[model samples]
Target: MPLENVHGDPIFTKINKVKKQYEYLTEDIETDVAIVGGGVTGAILGYYFSKANIHAVILEKERIAHGSTSITTSLLQYELDSNARELEEYTTLDNVITSYKLGLKALDEIEQFIKEYGNKCKYEKKDTLLYTSKEYEVKEMKEEYEIRKNAGIDVKYISEENNPFSLDLKAGVYGVNAGAQLDPYEYTHQLLDVSCNMGLKVYENTEVMEIAYGKDEVEIITSFGYKVKAKKVIIATGYNTQRFTKRNFGMKTVTYNIATKPVKSFDGWFNKILIRDNCDPYNYFRTTDDNRIIAGGEDVDFYTNIENEKLAKEKYSILLNRIKNMFPNIKDIEVDYEYCGGFISSQDNLGYIGEDPNHKNLWFCLGYGANGILFAILGGMMLSKLYKNEIDENLKLFKVDRFDK
Candidate 1:
């Protein structure tokens, strides 16, 4: 597939200027670990490995944080895009509980990093609210609310008066110990910057063209005609994994996001709650600590003519209209930034993290399911353990071979 698409505004322009220090595979160099893709997941993996005093090198096809990670609206909340009730059917009881709890653990890791590293990014522990306008769905959501509560997940349901939108909430689910978000680009850059300072190496515009695995080391060939060797290779590329490996574990879907101009004096319907509508293809909204309303969706895809800009123009119009309808006062504001990208999600919505069982020393941390941030953090911890030949019990649910059938 060709690189670069006509989606997403230029949000990560800084990474483009970071300069590539290590160039080409003229003479093979060895490292304890090689992490591919500089998105959030790969960056986190690099940071964790460097902390272990292991020599880790990260190779990116393009600039750091310039992929789907930057395109995300940065909803770091634990309220999953996957319906909790729906998940119980596809996965085992143990897996479901582990999956639900993992979000908070990831949150804790991020909070600790910010504290230890100093108040760097816009990290804030926030509350996420999923609500429906329709009364019937509200009734159904109450059942889901109970499912989480019964599992000791600390969730609650919102009655009509409790919601900010005048449109009565039929149902609402709340998760408290769930999340934190900063500017995706800034957050990613900080991790990478600090990681580099700690002796971890990051190379930009250095895409891995091919991989040939060996008994002890893996040979990575890049498009720019260079090769590097690493004891363990971590495939940190998201959505692009299908292009390079077995495609059984993940599938791709398109999603959209929009960042409106900073609002001056707007009265929002809700106070610091992320809201999700029960509409067909769901719509979710959150507020930045600075007061700008950032919103996006569980995107819906359609036929597109690459030459025509009709779809983009129409999508922007639709998004703006929805924001106006929900918060009547925010109509005149400018939609200065917006983004759209393809997200590679798993069937059960949990990311694939750990060493490839068949190929020793070949590890991957593919972001799947609902929470990419949560999965990315989870991926780092799991990979560090797997690198030391420690089996992470949670990894069984994400076995790439299990879906071979």
Candidate 2:
């Protein structure tokens, strides 16, 4: 079932139109690989697998890219939701650094894709500012900065005196050319647009009803009473993986955002850097190509049905007030769009991407963090390598059984 729509219109769908659609699956088919979701992760997998000369098809329960992909803030950062220093508590510092580098590589891969194909999405490279208004967080931020700097990452520590923003920041970490922003909806379709010509088959309005695993092949029965046989299956269904596994892998949360009308200027702000704070339930805001400010934060515990219009209004009001407090210069600021949606963060703050331990040839490409898009790219690459019998040592860090006893 599709997740309920909670609030105002998503800003991305407003700016972009769906370019492609597929008829529902009504007949049995066989393929080398079958992808179970049509969100960004599935689209990415479809692109990589198709490019590798592997036959692949995407089965989507609803319209492609209409799920969580549409509501993404699309802030492509190399940093994780849990900073490097914090992640070290869960894994080795070496592993943490490797994950960070992997994020940089994924970001570069996206740039390359845009270069080879065309940038249908509004993609742009930008600096990132991870700042803190609270004095207490300055120490941790500095530690994070030193760790990244020692690991050869381009970063700097800035105090309030040297801060470029009008906001009162006690300290901040300035990541040079470390982030990018784009229209995710357009990116998803653009990927499909390229992959479709490469023999990638995509079908929407197709739901997988049951799965029967075999030693050599996996068979999926769809709601339309059609069978799909594949040597391997990848579930990119985002937070709806309960139908396959029930290990409590995903930590779902409700996040909110408000997009303001295009502003005339960013007068006193820093170089349009992707800005996020160190505060718990931190606030993040960035500017779009058309000059609109999209800011989001104030996450709450997940609720199944978030379609409460009144609650959405209240949430938007709070978000707008926060924006006003941060940028007093954006006078008469009003929200042109507002929305709330569910997203998953993993226990270790890293994404899970590997074959299922109990089921051979059954794989997962769940990118379960704020770096969902980047992790999706990583998953696609790694999974493709795994299928071709190539070793990817990075998979050790994101093993699906990492939390298993």
Candidate 3:
């Protein structure tokens, strides 16, 4: 299947100065593992697999980190799409707590990577505030805060009296050191660069046209008919996984984002905390290394024609107004960048990362929802362990067919 235009003029790609290019596949290659897609997810997988001494090759249909990674907000939160109370309908509270801890573990993994390899990705650990402006939602927000606090998380409950931010808040959950932000484009390249040093091969502009499975190995044919013979295959194609599998994993939608020109000050932003509202179609706000505020939300049903400039303008306008209202005290909140991209969310608002039960030696590392980068980290660690025949109990939480059964 042909790849659709998955993103608009993503901010990260435009601002990223150092563009790294890789050669496309020219001759047939063989590896222990073949990773399809060179975005952040695939890059993370390559990093982990290469670190584990696994012979791996990454094939990207386009440029690396030029897909959904470019448009990602990179707000590393240890929270789910829904709060514990709401997610309890789809999963148990204990499972939700476990997922939160897993998110923190992923955050730690990223920090460790930065410590070992230098923080070139604008990595900064920040607090996260999940708040609600509406009076009716205060109870629900309080319930969420209590659940996290009771579960041994470092969370503080905020009410109208104790609210610290500029935004109107009836209630909020302030998670201390529970989130971080980074430059996704740079992170993807950095990961690939490090992995390449460990003998990870990456091929860009090389689309896999077909896959033929054998009893023990899989053969992937590139668009130019060059082949990749691998013992295992991993699909990290983000939201565009339908071409490889018959499973309908998640609901795909288009999420809009707008970045502001560097404001004079982040006065009322309170440590420039990563802010996420408890609204149905929630909005999230974060700051870049250059002090520009990037806010995104307002999701619509997925459409193939993502280049719809008219629709994009309308969504951008909505996002622009939201930021202005949310921080009216901050002057000159003009939009410096605006973009939209396809996103997916599962029933439990988590990612899928495990081998396909129906297809031998085939695995998926698709990280859906707002915490996709974190999920990708989890996938990289878990899948690498699986390659060594070690079983991670967390894999069951992200099993490919969890919802089906």
Residue-by-residue lDDT tens digits, candidate 2, 47-117: 99988889999999888998888788999888888777677677788887888899999999999999999
Greater-TM-score candidate between 2 and 3: 3
- Model 2 scores a TM of 0.97
In the predicted model 1, the residue pairs found to clash are 25-226, 25-227, 138-170, 138-171, 164-269, 349-369
Q: Tell how far residue 54 is off in model 1, in angstroms.
A: 1.9
Q: What is the lDDT of residue 156 in candidate 2?
A: 90
| Of candidates 3 and 1, the better by lDDT | 3
Compared with the true structure, what per-residue lDDT tens digits does model 1 show for residues 1-405? 313432757333322354233443344567889998988888899888888778899888776777877677667766566676666667775576677787778888998899889765677777777777786676668876887788788776787776655544667787775566677667777888788888888887787888888999898887767778888899888777754677566655556666677787566665566667767567777777666767676454422432235565666667777777877755556676766666655667777876676787777787775588788888888778777778778878767665566
> What's each prediction's TM-score?
0.90, 0.97, 0.97
Candidate number of the best lDDT:
3
Order of the predicted models by TM-score, top scorer first: 3, 2, 1
lDDT, candidate 3, 27-136, per-residue tens:
99899999999999999999999999999999999989888888899999999998887887899999999999999999999999999999989999999999999999
lDDT of each: 0.72, 0.86, 0.90
Clashes within 3 Å, all models in order: 6, 0, 0
Candidate 2, after superposition: displacement of residue 138 in Å? 1.1
Which sections of candidate 2 miss by over 4 Å?
5-7, 304-308
